[model samples]
Target: MRVTRPMLAVAGAAVAAAALAGCGSGGDAAAKVPPTATGSLESLAAEVKCKPNIQTDADTIRQAICTSSAGKFVLATFSTDRGQREWINEAKDYGGFYLVGRKWVAVGDDGVVTALRGTLGGDVEIGTDHHAHTGHTG
Candidate 1:
């Protein structure tokens, strides 16, 4: 069977078109935890202090900071006015943070939160937007 140059070109174009179509339709398909699956406010408070970032702090302080003036953090599904859906951490006491995919953010008493953002890559690795180090304690 002999394939002509024109036939090969047409085949290549079709393959390209199919690839583009797949790319265009590709949206984040990961199953997000529903907002309604949240447990008790106290349980959510306990979970927050256990997180790596705030774990080192005293449990009392953690609870105060997380549940007191801060508020209870609940896992909930959220949608913007524009209808973009996201899994968010809705802080009931003090404002909390959210994890949209792997990105994380923390809200403080001032109601301002800092997000640790990253760039999505074809590889499974993510590059953080910032870095931090702790000073040695003598």
Candidate 2:
């Protein structure tokens, strides 16, 4: 059977759709939660009823410290996914709870992060304590 251009187009579209469908959920409970907003640090902070105290505002990143009845947390937005991942990797060494969105991360105590998740609707990530990995001698 000779494949036609139309046939190839249809097949390509089908493959793309399937790939998108798989990405839609990412097979995670967090994906199911609808974020109040994404894209900007302010918007994400506002979702949790926070008046952000701007910390670092730059081309590559925008970060703020916020406080509410739930607690205080640091919210940061990155310019790229790569940047966000790198930041998270380095931050994990400090050990804390994180609520992650598309290009933003909220860092705080476990309770604060969990509460942010309820409103911000993002995945919860736990940072590893560097001390635990150290080979310390008494």
Candidate 3:
């Protein structure tokens, strides 16, 4: 068999595509936590250098109050993506900031959330204004 320029080009393109696919998370490396960070609420908290005061422990969610140098915040790990989304949706009405990971979420004020993002490697989601609920009777 004789090698050709076209065959070499095709092989190179396939290799490049495979390499990009290995990234898995849309190639956004900053949006993923380290391997050890997803094990539990405690481990995730540890990544942000917090001591968790666990508040809710259930089959669906585990939550804690954590105070790191960044400040105090709520740390929670969920059993499923749907559960996390539901909880975040409800919590957002209270008006706060969220640092979200695979199955975990951290709730705090803007500064705290910003600080947590540095160590946690997740996306920041802003909550709706709590004051919006004041005038509504229903």
Candidate 4:
């Protein structure tokens, strides 16, 4: 059969739909728990051999600096449902994946995201834009 542009478009759309469907869940019940309980920044920092300099900037979230064997990264905890929703919206807008749990982890590089997978209990996604360097995500 001769492949046509229209045929390719249809096939691509189908694949994308299937992928989005799968994104509904990360496939691990544990991954659904709070990121802090399982893969919180303090936990991850210890795992990666980093020390976390933590701070609470608002009632909405807690941010931290994790300087580890891997590299410096930020982590955050949301105080309310609105904060979490805002985070998801912001992430989608900037082309990132929310490593879902009781909380989320947003990293900037594939390597950092990938390395955190085991701790996070699955693959985490990175953003196309530059991640905040100072502390946890906003």
- TM-scores for all candidates: the values are 0.20, 0.70, 0.68, 0.51
Shift in Å, residue 108, candidate 1:
38
TM-score of predicted structure 4? 0.51
TM-score-based ranking, best first?
Answer: 2, 3, 4, 1
The digit string of per-residue lDDT tens for model 2 on 12-40 reads 99999988877785546455567545868
Query: Per-residue error at 104 for model 4, in Å?
Result: 3.4
- True lDDT of residue 60, candidate 2: 93
Order candidates by lDDT, high to low: 3, 2, 4, 1
Give lDDT: candidate 3, residue 44.
85
- Scored by lDDT, model 4 comes in at 0.59
Q: Which residue pairs overlap in candidate 1's backbone?
A: 35-76, 35-77, 70-93, 70-94, 71-93, 71-94, 72-93
Candidate 3 lDDT over 53-111, as tens digits, reads 99999999999999999999999999999999999999987789998888999999998
Candidate 1 lDDT, 1-138, residue by residue in tens: 256888999999999998787667543322222232123323443334423223323311222233333333222222232221221222322223343322222233222121121111111211232224336454
**Model 4 lDDT tens row, 75-112:** 66676657866776676556644444465454544555
Q: Residue 92 CA error for candidate 1 (Å)?
A: 41
Runs of candidate 3 with Cα error greater than 4 angstroms are 1-37, 131-138
Give the C-alpha miss distance for residue 93 in model 2, angstroms. 1.0
Candidate maximizing TM-score: 2
